[model samples]
Target: MGEFFETYRPQLIYALIVVLSVLLLRFLTNLLYKWLLKQELKKYPNEKPKAVNWVKRILNALWLVLGVIALSSLIVNEDKYDILKHNFKLILYLGILSIVTIVGAASANLWFRVSINRKIQNAEDPTSFKFLRYIAVFGIYITGILFALLAFPSLEGIAKTALGGAGVIALIAGVASQEALSNLVGGVFIISFKPFIIGDIIKVTDTMVGTVVDITLRHTVIRNFENKMIVIPNAIINKEKLVNYNLGELKICERIEIGVAYDSNIDLAKKIMQEEAQKHPLILDNRSPTDILNGNPVVRVSVTSLNDSSVTIRAWAWARNYSEAFDMRCELLEAIKKRFDNEGIEIPFPYRTVVLKKEKETHKNHDAGQTAE
Candidate 1:
C-alpha cells in the first residue's frame, strides 16, 4: 500500500485537486450566475427567467473550460512530476483534445439554444431554425475536432493530405448526400418564399392536413387535429401539393351542403340555411347588407343542384379562420337539420315506386293452378 501510494502520489493528488477545484468552481459559478441574473432582471423585468437561463448556459460552458485548464496546469508542470516526462507530449495533446471537445460541444449547444429562443421571442418563423442551428453546431464541432487532431504531430501529415483532397472529398459528399442537399436547398427556398409560416394550417396531403408546427432543413413538422405530429420531408413538400389557409387573409369562406326533399319549400330552405349560418358565433359579420346584395356576405344560401332524389341547398358563410370555419359549418349543419325536422321539411333518401304487371301476375296464377292439379 505504501509503495502503491508512493507510485501514484502525483496522480492521486492531481485527482483530489481536480475534484476540489470542480466543487469550488461550481459554487463560485452558481453565485456568479445568480448575480448576473439579478443584473439582467433589472434590465429585462418581463424576461428575467430567459435572461438568467442564457447567462447560466454561458457560465456552464465557461466552467467546463476553466476546469479542464486548471486540471491540465496541475499535471503539466515538468518540475513537479517525472511520471509524464517520457509521455508528456502525448498526455498534453490528449488533455488539449479533451478540453477542446468539451468546450466545443457545450458552447455549440448553448449558443444554438439561445439562437432558437431569440428567434421565437422575435416572432420569427422558426421552421428552419432547428435545422440551421444543428448544421452550425455540427460544423463548429467538426472544426474543433480537426483542430484537436492537429495537436498530435503524428496526425499532421494525414490532416495535410485530407485538406489537399478537399475538392474530391466535397464532390463525393455532394453525391452521397444528394437528398440531404436537396432538402437543405428546399428549406432555404421555403423560408425565402414564405409559402406558409409556422402555425399556418396547411394540407400537405388529404390525410396529412394539420397546423405547421415547425420547419427544418430536412422536414416540415405538423400537429394534426388528433394531436399527432406529422413530419414531411422538405424536398417532398416542395414537389407535392400544399394548401396554406393563413395566406392572403385571416378570413375563410365555409361551404355547407344539405339535401332537402324536392317537394319541400325551396325558398324557406334557403332562408333557414342562411339564418342557421348567421347564428353561429364564429361567422364573420363585418360585411354590410350592400355587400350581401353584391354576392358577398357572412351568410348566403342558394340551390346548387337538382338531383333525382333531392334539391341541394348550399350555404356559404365567412369565418375568422380555418378552425372557426370548420366549427361554423358543423354548427350550421346541426341547426339546419333540427329546423328542417321541426318545420316538417323532409330530407330525401333514394327510393323507387313499384308497379305490378297484370300479364305477369296472370301467368304466375295459371302456373300455380297447373302445379296444384
Candidate 2:
C-alpha cells in the first residue's frame, strides 16, 4: 500500500484536500453569515447595515471560485489536462467575469451611499440628482464589464482584428447617419447649454410660448398656458430660432391700432395715449416713446383706406411683463374709447361708393335677354 501510494500520493492528497476544503469552507462561511451577521443584520434593517451581509456573501462566493479552481488544477496534471490545458483562455475569461461580479456586488452599497450623498450635498433637485446618479452608477458597471471583456487575452486578439475595419465601417455609418448623429449631439448640446431649464417660459420664432418642462438629450418639453405639452426636437431647436423668456430683460413691446376722425386733433390723441400709458404702474417710462409720423411709403398704419371720417394710427408701448403689457393694452383701449367719445374723434370703418347705375344696367340686361328669347 505504501509503494502504491508513493506513485500518485501527492496528486491524490492535493485533490482530496482541495475538495474537502472547498466543501467545508463553503458550509462554514454560510453558517457563519446566517448565524452571526444575518441575524444581527435582520434586526438592524438599514441598507448600509445590510450591506455587510452582502459583503460576506461575496467573500464566500469568491472563496468558492478559488476553491473550484484549485480542485480542478489538482485533479489533472498541467500538461495532460484535457480541458485545463486546451481551454486556458476560457478559464481566464471566466475568472475575470467572476472577479468583476464580485467587485460590483461588494461595492454596490458603497456606490449607492456615496452617490446619494453627493447628490444631496450638491443641493440640486433631489429627484433629478438621484436619477442621474443612479444612471451614472449603472454606467460605471457597464463600462467595467466592457473593460473586462477587452482585458481577456483571447478576446483582445480577436477584438484587435475586428478593429482593423472599424474605421471604415464607422466612416460609412457616419456619412449615412450624419443628420441623426447631429441630432444626437445636438441633444447633448441642449442639455449642456441650458438654453432653458425646466419651468422657464420660452418662445421660439414668435410662434411658440410655454414653460420649459424638460430638456432631454434629443428633445425639449414645454407646457404652454393651455396646459398642453409641446415636444420639440433638439435638432430643430438648435437649427432654427429660439428665445428663452427667462433670460430676456423682462420687457416686451405691445402694439395697439387706433384711428381718429380726420378732423379730430391728432396731436391730442397722441398725448392722451401717451398719458394713459405713463399712468400704468408696470409701464417702463425710463425711455422716451415716439409718436406716429406721416408720409411713410410702407405704412404700418397708414391712411389705409381713407375712411370718409378718420385716419388710422397704430400706437406701441413697451412694458415690463407680458401679463402687464397685455393688461395695459386693454386699459389703454378703454382710455382711448373714453377720449374719442369725449372729443368726438371718429374711428371710422371702411366705406365704398355703390353707384345706382348698377341696378339699372342689370334691368337692361334682363330686358335684352327677354328680347333674345
TM-score list, all predictions: 0.65, 0.49
Query: What RMSD does each model have against the real structure?
Result: 7.4, 10.0
The total of clashing pairs for model 2 equals: 1
Candidate 1 ranges with C-alpha deviation above 4 Å: 1-95, 122-124, 127-129, 145-175, 286-297, 350-373
lDDT of predicted model 2: 0.63
TM-score attained by model 1: 0.65
Clashes of 1: 1
Model 1: per-residue Cα lDDT over 296-329, one tens digit each:
7567788999899999989878888889888778
Alpha carbon deviation, residue 138, candidate 2 (Å): 8.6
Which candidate's TM-score is highest?
A: 1
- Tens digits of per-residue lDDT, candidate 2, 1-373, equal 9888899899788878877887887788778767856654574445444544654666577667666666677657767676664355555455556556545644553565566566557754333433344345544554445456566667665445434556434533545566665665676666566666555677885657887766554566778778898888778877766776656577777776787777777767766666666666666643423322433221122233345567766666777777677788898889878977887766666688876998989999999999999
Task: Estimate every model's Cα lDDT from 0 to 1.
Answer: 0.75, 0.63
